[model samples]
Target: MATKRLMKEYNSIQKALSDTQEYENIVSLEPTGDLFSWCGVIRGPSNSPFQAGTWKIKIEVPQNYPIAPPKMKFVNKLCHPNVNFQTGEICLDILQNQWTPAWTLLTTMSAILLLLQDPEPTSPLNIDISNLLKSGDIKAYNGLIRFYTHKYAIDSV
Candidate 1:
């Protein structure tokens, strides 16, 4: 069932890419070898610090996918409150405790695009970035994100 489902998703992504729009933020989503490992590229939304960047992500689907959400991490470094700078581990509820079987890989990537725009500082992986946001230093926070986005997030998969 899991393999069948993963194959469906793989085809879905291919179909999505075939369209002209091809998911506005999703640059690409391709399986590495089999159904379990995949790689993707997500372009940052406009009017945001990450606007000029394209971020790559790695995905690992568990055997019980749908029942268990696939694990994802950034291939390029991203400096944000909810993302671990060193490991690229994301701190979003949907990727963790709040996940539901109803969520698809495409929706999850959309959620990540939203995260780039609106970060939740409360549960942060990068203390410095989180603190800046928590303290209401919008200028510095945006500046750092912009800086890092240019430096690290510009690389593609």
Candidate 2:
């Protein structure tokens, strides 16, 4: 049986998708059985080492979604402080215990976009990358990101 919370979440997600202006390279939702999942394609921000690159991500909602936050990860290789190298798991506060009942799919997506724009090194999934980003070595950071962007993001195309 579908709970009221689940129904509301489903409806909200559907409405957001229909209402939002679709970006050429951005996140989108796909239906799977009775559940729904999101597939996100983010264009690297300008001036960032990942610029001109595209990265794919996946957001998997649990059966008890809403009550528990959805899981998100990059489908393609991503070298970021908050993203896991092997599993693609993202380390975002919203997806963890900090999740609130008022948060919606749109809010979560917006947070992700913001994270790409300005990553938080304090709480990161990639320790080395996080340390580098915190060290304020912009050149090295850009170099490493560019290297991965080329090796994993661009070369795949």
Candidate 3:
């Protein structure tokens, strides 16, 4: 049942990608060698520090997916308050305690996109980065963000 549901979702995502030109370049979601594992790329939004960057993410669909949220992490390094610098762990509520069966991979990615725009500094995974952001050191924070975005996030993959 889990594989079946994932296949369905995968098909739907592929269809959506094909149908929607806007999302075509911004993101790419594809299954990995294993059906339960998937990979994706999210282009940095314009007018942000991450502009010109492309972020890669990995998604693992649990055996009991839909009943539980998928596990997702950035495959590349990013200097963000909600993202762990070392492990790429994401501190999003929906991906953790607040997850619901109604949330799908698409929704999760949408949430991640939103996170890029508005970070939750109080609940941070990278303390130093969070501090920089909270302390109003916009110059330093954006510098770090741009550096890492150029180094790790901008990839052909």
The number of the candidate with the highest TM-score is: 1
lDDT of 3 by residue, 7-102 (tens): 888888878877876564447888899888999888888878988888889999989888889999998788889999999899999999999988
User: Could you tell me which 10 consecutive residues in candidate 3 have the lowest summed lDDT?
Assistant: 17-26
TM-score, each model? 0.93, 0.78, 0.92
> What is each predicted model's overall lDDT from 0 to 1?
0.86, 0.74, 0.85
Backbone clashes in model 1, listed as residue pairs = none
Task: Evaluate model 3: give its TM-score.
Answer: 0.92
Task: State the lDDT of candidate 2 residue by residue for 36-73, as single tens digits.
Answer: 56565667766677787777777777777677887888
lDDT of 2 at 72: 80
Q: Clashes in model 2: which pairs?
A: none
Once fitted onto the true fold, the runs of candidate 2 whose alpha carbons sit more than 4 angstroms away are: 1-27, 155-157
Q: What's the ranking of the predictions by lDDT, best on top?
A: 1, 3, 2
Clashing pairs in 3: none
Worst 10 residues of 2 by lDDT: 23-32
Candidate 2 positional error at 67, Å: 1.2
